[model samples]
Target: MKTSLIKLTLPLAAAGLLAACAGGPQPPDWQLEAKGSMDRSVAAYMEGNSRVEMAELERARTQLTRSGRADLLATAELLHCATRVASLVVDEPCTGFEKLRPDATEAQRAYADYLQGKVQPQGIPLLPESQRAAAAGNAGALQGIADPLSKLVAAGVMLQTGKASPEVITQAIDTSSAQGWRRPLLAWLGVQLRRAEQGGDTQAADRLRRRIELTQGISAAARPLTPVTKP
Candidate 1:
């Protein structure tokens, strides 16, 4: 009887060990790599480096696909679409936004809604009540997000809807500029400048234009050097 009991206990212990080994960590290496690439892409976008941003995004897509992280992949695809919109690539229509899975996190969903509204402000009337509510709420909630890109999108949405004062948007842009996020800083300033012009606020428009010019100079100075040919 003792020998039989020992045999049963040893098999159970071995099976438990096998289970532990198979389970491994929660997020595997590919998931981590994909997330890391996504982060890098966002950072690049903030810094006004579109080339690097697109390249890093591609890496993230590949890694996420390999890891079977479908949710994150969908989020990345949405981000790619947002970047294209930000870059004003009007020639190519943004696709795949409608196909994003519904299981995305709240933050992801909010960001996507903000992007959609930005791309098609007229379509806001067609959105579900819940989506409109989320977009409105995210205008304030997204300010607290750690990622600069998310904060910028939130600010943009608020600015478009007249929910955020120009001062608030200016403050957000200033904060990003202080952190060296030149691309987004310039973009937001341009939006404000245009609004001021349309509103006939000459003083505000001039101030914004000067700010835009200064930021453009800084961005040009910070750009990576290209090979020069001797004539």
Candidate 2:
């Protein structure tokens, strides 16, 4: 009976050891924390809450780094950098983006390209050939991008390259404005307004000026006025 008991215990002990080596059934706490934070950050960004998005992204970065999850860490870093770039925050380099996983999703890859193009429109040759071609006013380029923001960026690229027609860019700007994407809408309007002026299209330029003023007024109205405090 004693020998049989020892034999039964030995296999159970080995199995337990193997399970421990496998890192157990549940994920580490930090990984779960990081994933939750990332989801919230993305949600905040989509809702256009820049302050909340940045804060959540910073939390995700910290949690991912603590978890030693390199893939997630890289993704978080890329998102953080991309947000900063979109907000026109100067001096913040897009670090760890080049180290993104080879199998990164299409959205991730597209965003990286957009950032690179924005940073060095005249010199960076990193954007995909197909996207570059799209920037040259090929409607086909728009087909590959499913994300609205990416499509908008692609259209902006076309405008910057002097390859898109006024009608094409105006359509893009209108779409962004309808979606309440104020930043991109304003930026695209500024670009088209400048183009109209340079071409001596006084009528088109005046229309763009009025649109800019109206958009700015709407934005200002949406913002809460700060209360004055007495010293």
Candidate 3:
């Protein structure tokens, strides 16, 4: 589901490449490079590859900077923040995008608000297609999003709105698991594990615990360790 504000605004891989092949006017070099880098950055972040995520983000920033389009840069930052929100990292104030807010279009501002749980009725039309119905309080609309990441982001928004039902949580977990996005998979599993424990469903809790342990083990082994010293 290429449903983010950036995705709505940008041409994607197959179509853009085909256009180039057909000798049609292609997207500007900076646009293509920025979009690709940003997409990789989001995917790497979802997969818990922080090193690659930051590297690709920097590449995106470089390309966007070359274009001198602050709005586009702001869109990139919002995309990064939105992915974090979807992964349950909900504390972001989107300062990077906020710094460039004056240059952002109405749709960009609406998306920024949407990520922050400030969805307004007037802003609904401006939001990405996959999220519009969800923003309007229809959780079923999430199921309509074919893209896993888009559904997750929409679910995150529903969570903020006090509407993340059990089914939504399950879908989020399934999507994260299917995508091999360990970060969100762990986050959603933790949510389910807590619920299972609270409900005294020992069987479910045990199963979730083992899954969490397996996922964490894989992530820990792939991640580099940093030592800390006490003063």
Candidate 4:
């Protein structure tokens, strides 16, 4: 099973790409927290029932919309990711994902038109993540499927529990991003490490070392995704 999982990830993960949103003002800190929270809730939603209840999605949508700070651009990106990841969960068919996805906001409508087989006049890359992972099922592939902010959820959760150092954590993110990965990979790295530890795979653990080691002969600096704020 470990080998099976790795095989699935090898081609996809090998590239180590990260997703980036077009430049814009970031949502407020509170919105950031809400968006981050929604992500963890989403994982639980996916891991258990394969889909979240409409109520749950509504709550997330509500939180995201609060403060008059709705980020439709980010929301559409989130839905795009959710739609794609729906294909990955073996337990869940991608049935209602299209409908179940939080309604796309007006700003996101343009994006939807493009996704629904329509072409926008502009040549912007609306499908970076999918384009990056076309032939593989690596996390980088999922980078397109999952919201970049969603990655912060795991890291935030870890940080909240005091399991990691913010400084070292920041370093970990910097190290990976300098290599052409997105900032979110820092958080996903947290999830991946936890997965390896739980599965008790030394080989996988060693793989982390080989993957993270740099020209300096030091292992990739990974700190637990410890959150500084309260839950």
Ranking by lDDT: 3, 1, 2, 4
lDDT of 2 by residue, 3-55 (tens): 01111111212222113224676665665565567656654553345677678
Tell me the deviation in Å of residue 98 in model 1: 3.5
Name the top lDDT candidate: 3
* TM-score against native, each model: 0.62, 0.56, 0.85, 0.31
Clashing pairs in 3: 1-147
lDDT of 1 at 188: 64
Clashing pairs in 1: none
Off by over 4 Å in 1: 1-26, 81-99, 102-111, 118-134, 137-147, 221-231
Local error of candidate 4 at 221, Å?
38
Best by TM-score: 3
Q: Which scores higher on TM-score, 2 or 4? A: 2
lDDT tens readout by residue for model 4, 160-188: 23333434244434433443332233233
> Model 1, range 85-175, lDDT digits (tens) per residue?
3332223434544555465444444445556555244444443333344255444444444444444544545554556566656655675
lDDT of 3 at 80: 83
Each model's lDDT: 0.53, 0.52, 0.76, 0.35
**What are the C-alpha RMSDs, in order, of all predicted structures?**
14.3, 15.2, 5.5, 15.5
Clashing pairs in 2: none
As a whole number from 0 to 100, the lDDT of residue 90 in candidate 1 is: 24
Model 1 residue 32 CA deviation in Å: 2.2
| Candidate 3 lDDT, 63-89, residue by residue in tens | 978867676677788878888777877
